[model samples]
Target: MTLPITTTAQVRQSLLDRHEIALLDVREEDPFGQGHPLFAANLPLGRIELDIRSRVPRLDTPIVVYDNGEGLARTAGERLRAIGYTQVSLLQDGLRGWREAGGELFIDVNVPSKSFGELVESQRHTPSLSAEEVKRLLDSSADVVVLDARRFDEYQTMSIPGGTSTPGAELVLRARAQAPNPATQIIVNCAGRTRSIIGTQSLVNAGIPNPVAALRNGTIGWTLAGFALEHGASRRAGTASDPQRAEAAVAARAVADRADVRRADTARLAGFLAESARTTYRFDVRSPEEYLQGHVPGFRNAPGGQLVQETDVSAPVRGARIVLADDDGVRANMSASWLAQMGWEVWVLDGLTADSFSERAPAPPALPAPSRPVQWIAPRALADALAREAPGTTAIIDLTTSANHVKRHIPGAWFVLRTDLPQALARIPRARRYVLTCGSSLLAQYAVDEIAQATGAQVLVLDGGNQAWADAGLPVEAGEQRLASPRTDRYRRPYEGTDNPREAMQAYLDWEFGLVEQLGRDGTHGFRVI
Candidate 1:
């Protein structure tokens, strides 16, 4: 099918006008991170069938997919069409066309949100304390509270010597409880700059009485400054007192009002959800634990700090309406205020009682059925086949993320990207029968026909994939034991691990420092700070 062509100029204009248009880069994370349009969200061709429905909920919403001479865009567009999308188009000539038309190409994922953070820091002049300075305060036992404005898991990984996990959304709400004394100093830190800036600014915006500043460069700077980090930290912010909650709600509401964030009651939320023409994302911007306890039926859990940092992953459909909910009024409003400033049509769900949250446990992902019938084998049966046949006779291909594959996977499984099957299959030894599995077996099920057609071998899916194998007390292997494809599914963040070279860490910081200028050059980011 011939997909309509969307010009670079049109896409740029749509972004500038704040129109609802999803600019997608249908390439793997590594390539997409190398270069892409400012607002282009990476939805790899392999994941389109599994994630497109949720990321771009409104099938009729305009979407333009592109690739860099990879020829994946046309296939992606066709796939979108096959899945009931009405308005799918291709970028004229793909990535090359964008560059030729002078469109700004940004490196790294979440460029839009990262650049917006740089802009916010530049305009607001958010206060910060150097790692050395913060260290001195800690050594002297100063009256200061260090708040790690990152996810709990990230905080548990590595944190400042004395820091508590109070994610960005909870900063304003929990700051009072952590530092009740008005004279106590508060320091916000994340792995890197964006969250630190945003978290510190959030406190300043909420009119927190205590002095607030970001830990400059966060843990990266601390490590570079020869400071030791504490691992497996469990410190976390507790619930706010009644008076603290009331004060925080008032302050957060004022900030949201200033940012022009809208408020909606249950009736209004129903109207937004019922609107078929618009894509509305209902999210509970609280921690995953809180979400699993109980949450609004339709709302998905997207922790507020990570949601702001990774908007592209949470809401790939640019210009979609976002409604945030939290039983504690403060988290939703605080998060909504930032979304509003980022040019999102965001709303805070008001008037939520304890009874409002009745649903428990994580919701199953919404997915479409496989294009064709798929043959399956039970985990034990597959285990027996491996023992019964020659080592290479029954080859196993794992289509899960490389990181997860390295952590735990079926024994002797060759990790391969589903989209890279054509090339990857040639590398793996020819086998009489092949087995495919992913985290849930869903992705593997979708690839059964493709692998069978390419290799001319009988293809069968592991009944429940890697998760089930582990669940049934099956032995699994770890590390990059076998790989048919490169580990490029996810771009490695410079600030994620401890082994990063000093040069790379410094280079990443330099890049972030220049994002303000990049934002100006792009001229499509409609970011405004109140």
Candidate 2:
């Protein structure tokens, strides 16, 4: 069947014009990972028939599918037609065709958001003072505050010789308290660009009276510029009053004065819980490790930094009330302020702890049982399938980040980031069978589950994930691309070996626990938590 194909120029123009179109790349993930058009969703062809409908609710929505060549397009088109999708079309000649036609292709670089942050730093021309600049300022006795916008752990790990730990979001709220004098110049930085750009921008955006600029490229840039970062443990924890508690106190005061913040006592909180049936999103904004150990009932683990960084990807619903659970109020309050600024109805759930409500709160949700009807294949059988079908027919999908997939992956495997799975199914060739793998078996199982739920595709999981694949003595690829840094080029202080990693860890934990408690306390009142 001759399917409708959209050209690169047309796709670019559509994006430029802000037209309502969903760009679907239907290729095995590895090739898709090598590069793809920006904002293109990946839904591998094998799963297109099932998953596309869920993501694109309207059958009439313009859905453009593309593969490496014409063969996949035809197969995908046929499947869409069989599924009764009237508006389904293909990308002419696939991605190669798009590029051949002078269309722009975007590299699926890891840390694009972090990179975009660097661009913001460049664009805003946020200031940075080198050692020489600092020396001059100090010599002149200038009123300049060198604020380290990284975590307290990082500040202790390494910071500008005289900088104080203010973290990022808190810079704006605590600026008055920390620095006091509005005339003082504020220099904010993280280990690298993200926090620095974000921190400097936050203060400037908040209309701080002081001049603010991020240290260019952060500490790495500083080092490259022949400046030195200090590396002694900080004498004390950079303690600040908890914003939620402060806000609550302010609200309490308003009860007597002009009512600004509303205070909800236990009775009010209980009543609010009884009255509301809205879908509340409870996040345990603690480390995944901590979450795996023990967390509040019904709360999903979402690290605070990652939660802030990937809010759109994580929670698509704009109006959902988000309740953040942390051990203490600091991180939760910091996260709440950012979310609130972004127009989310966010609240810090305070006070819950492993000790305080262990038995009182509901039990943790039960883990879903494995329900695969297909018997596990033997290693030899899997090897024979790979030998026979891998070269031309079978597509191995490593549902990991492109960077990790590129670094080291199953030989002949394609990269399909979990985020792009929906689009891959819509655009990749469906004639081939698929084997899903990830860093671990759990993620592989997750991919299989998502695919099964979306489409009744005959997909199989790599039993042991990447480890199993390696253990099977299957071919593995390795390259420098596989190595990923625990830290970004941007400034972020390491928490390890700091004078008080435990104390810092405890503080963060307390903040996250407090947040969960606060959310349960708030329930569905006038304030939305998300």
Candidate 3:
């Protein structure tokens, strides 16, 4: 199972040459969040069989997979080959070799994006208003509008007092509508720092006349400052009026011109994509609902503000050409302007007719049916089997992911990695029958025979996996229990969910706060402030 090996030095050289390289970490997110090289993408082994093409896209792109000391890279490479990826390699000696070679390792998930946000703050002194200052303004009834620059659902989760949900790219198009008076002060906030700075700067870049500022450090900072966040907020910035839209377009076009952002018609976009020497990503910089309603043929939905904040996650190839599309030019232009400063070859796609968006984009591609036939049992049948059998006779093994296993799974399913199943079967109580399940039963189907051979048990794949079980009005339980495998596939992100401890939250902020210095020391990112 040994594949061609790539050293950390070679990976660093590729970066210096500005080559498109995906340093993929094959472990789950939990370990990935602990530490990794700055540019490494977390592509856990469990999902590699499903998401390779969509995530990496190019078959020939150089990819180096690592897993610290887990020994999962070679197995992952084999899976990549099954899916037709040609340029896959293992990191020599894993993460330890990376350190020995003097490569800098960073902690936390989405490090590239978070570090970039800090770089933006360092480069451009994006204006801000402390929670205390904002509180005083609110108490005095000042003419100010607080806008939450996160998704509507996120805004509803926790928002500043009286803040409207005006997610990223919409800042320019809807700010005027939210605050009609240019003389009035405007405040923008997000959960933490990235969206707040990016949102406030978007207004400044568009030459908006209002005195705008980010609610300093967003809701996290507010909480840190002893201010209560407003939950279940319903305020939103709806579609802009004709005059406001026209005005926003003019400002955006001007900013785009300043950023030297080129405009590409459909033909030009196609031509750029046709060039084999470079990679071109075309995305629609609009809300997901708008994109879902209708979108162009090949463009993916990448809401503008989040796109800028998560460039590495969205577009791993640093020097690739990115084409952004929007019905109105405001979102695309403003987003491209910031990306240009961040050293990307970015463009705005143009000449879209009403017909361009007449159809909705397709759902994400599904995993193909497994090549080898495996036994299948419907959710109801499986439920009945669990009740009919003695307590430990039937082992219900779930391969969905440690994260999902913790969230919810089939009531008593033991979460196990497919790779670990062969080695782990001997330890579990001998069972006469076994049932396998995952997000979809697609992957579980392939593992049925392997489990049967390893454990000498009659194995069956759950017909529709957990999704179908949940759809059938079945109750599911949640916990880190009945584990046949370690929870190593998914990282616990500090900036991820709402329930992070204060120490982890503060530590994450401090890590981000110190990133500009790290970026300076590493000297890889060619970021500039415009």
User: TM-score of the candidate numbered 1?
Assistant: 0.98
The estimated TM-scores of all candidates read 0.98, 0.47, 0.93
Q: How much does candidate 2 score in TM-score?
A: 0.47
Model 2, which residues run further than 4 Å from truth?
1-187, 191-194, 197-279, 286-294, 303-306, 350-375, 378-397, 410-435, 441-460, 468-477, 480-530
Q: Candidate 2 or 3, higher lDDT?
A: 3
Clash pairs, model 1 backbone: none
Sliding window of 10 residues with minimal summed lDDT for model 1: 361-370
lDDT of 1 by residue, 359-394 (tens): 997677778788878888999888877887877898
Against the hidden true structure, what lDDT does model 3 obtain? 0.82
lDDT of 2 by residue, 356-419 (tens): 2232333333333333543244445667887776465666667654556666787766666454
| Tens digit of per-residue lDDT, candidate 3, span 337-442 | 8787777778998888888887685556546445457888999988887888789888888988777888999887888887566545765677889988998887
Off by over 4 Å in 1: none
For model 2, the run of ten residues with the poorest summed lDDT: 484-493
